[model samples]
Target: MTGRPRLADVAARAGVSMKTVSNVINDFQHVSADTRARVQAAIDEIGYRPNLSARNLALGRAGLIALVVPQLDMPYFAALAGQVLQAAAKRDWVVLIQQTGGDLTVERDALAGRFPQRIDGLILSSTAVGSAELRKRTDRTPLVMLGDRNYQGAAQHVAIDNVAAAAAAVTHLAELGRRRIAMIGSSPGDRRHPRLVGYRLAMKAAGLPIDDRLIKPVRNNLGEEGEQQMTALLAEHAQDPPDAVFCVTDWVALGVVRALRTRGFRVPEDVAVVGFDDIPYGRAATPTLSTISPDRSAIARLAVDSLQAQFEAAAAGTAYEVGEQQAAFRLVVRESSGG
Candidate 1:
């Protein structure tokens, strides 16, 4: 014998069917008192313990909520995940993490009832997938949305006001007397990320003349993407370059700093920089980054609390009230803004 007790073995030892043993273990009323006693005796004799995963599967309730995100390697998401875990622990809810790599198909699949029989709820941190697509499959599950995706109240979402946050970051730089400000991570019509919208509003608010050359569009939201664009910008505007730059994410800002160093531009003195998503690296960089700090812990709190509301509404046979909830944000002043 492998010395590991299985449900079938327990059933055989008790002279009962596997289903009856399952019922006995679960305290299903269908099992007779005599049968329950016999199953208990067998379990004790065999030192058999129920498999949590198997038990959860048989009951169709795992007490597990899913946290789906783009990538855990991203510092912001990793930090968010840690907060979500602590938040879930407070409610005695177990979390199963899923990384979809920000793929639309994977995001869609997460809401497609694949775990309807296992997971009690799901929280998705999405960067892509539109409202229509989210609506088609999300209504059945108790789901909470996170991050900057604007789904127009399609789901219960907890996020920061990206437009306002970005504006705040830029306003901080402008206050520092930096006029020629450049922006990276500009995707003109990508509503999934609202940084572009925020940048435009902030520039206009500061009464700074918008330069088309300063708005660099990055197809990828990675450090290298920012580095490549910043390098080119350095070469293009050697004499009359931008005095400051804003990036959509801290990862991009790190690259911008790298490129600036390679091009011999002193941070804050020559080019003030601001980034969003105050990642860990932002603080430790050569010139610590000034950034808009979205309250991630608050997002985790509101999201978990919101999901609890989702579950309660479902239990009461009422409709889940969905809305766009913006958590607080603040511009964290560090060496990068020279503030």
Candidate 2:
């Protein structure tokens, strides 16, 4: 019944004082749980939107952060960017995205622009840019390094234990009686190389010989490349193909499945398959993919929380050190791996 629902309106509706509603909005932490719940319900019922712009202006913040990924073409990065945006939304900040194609020049250009001027901070998922190159930057912008590579420099970082996760994937396949398992989809000079090392370690531990032929390297991590590699692998070992395939990513697993079906092999029955990332599509695939799934929510939360902390320190002209933040991952057993 008004132009816009105000804090006073919510206070009146909730039968609480304006100061109590303000305390609830600001999250003062001293408010009673019952009071907080009442105020929140009133806010929801009236669709009362907080003036984040005014808040940002008062705090001298831009209310914006850039989430820069190598490329949106990869489902992993696309999904991650979405998760980061959602996480930022929970903190009342906006997230804009930029694609660098993993090009050092593009990444450098973004850094040179003095981020934190237009935007408050940046979450960079760099593939080509190294920690050394990032170390060269002198700006005090609040930054958090996300997936792909490990940055050992000064800024904040959030990633999964790739080596451990990969080893777990291979170990799962081996435990399922999958001998002659092929690990495919690797690009040279990519952070995913650790996964390869993990695979090798797992195979050796299982007393299985590491056959070079079984370690297929695709031109890219796309599904089509996985399909191509699978075709060649099937033809190369038509008489005696590998019993299982562990792809570096879920996209590649899709292709592996396609190749197997084309060559008339029943999944799990003829050749078990496992893929990483555990993207949503994997769950709905003809044979659900069994793979390593990282806790993206944890990663996003850590990255956002770290950046927020850094920003607060920078604004206060105080010392701030962003430590390494790691997310947990789990091996998901599904139909693809005969689980």
**Backbone clash count for every predicted candidate, in the order shown:** 0, 0
Instruction: Enumerate residue pairs that collide in model 2.
Output: none
Q: Give model 2 RMSD, 1 decimal.
A: 3.5
Candidate 1 residue lDDT tens string, 251-301? 999999899988788988999999889999999988899888999999998
Worst 10 residues of 2 by lDDT: 185-194
Worst 10 residues of 1 by lDDT: 187-196
Compared with the true structure, all predictions reach lDDT values of 0.85, 0.85
Task: Report the Cα RMSD per candidate.
Answer: 7.3, 3.5
Tens digit of lDDT per residue, candidate 2, span 1-339? 669999889999899998898788878899999999999999999999878887688678889988888878887887888888889998888988899876878787677654544888888887677778778887667888876466775568899988888889999989988889898876433444778878888999998877778778886678899999999988898788999998989999999999999889999898999999988889999899998899888888889888889898988889887667789999999998887
- Please report how far candidate 2 places residue 268 from its true position, in Å: 1.5
In model 1, state the lDDT of residue 227: 95
Error of 2 at 237 (Å): 3.5
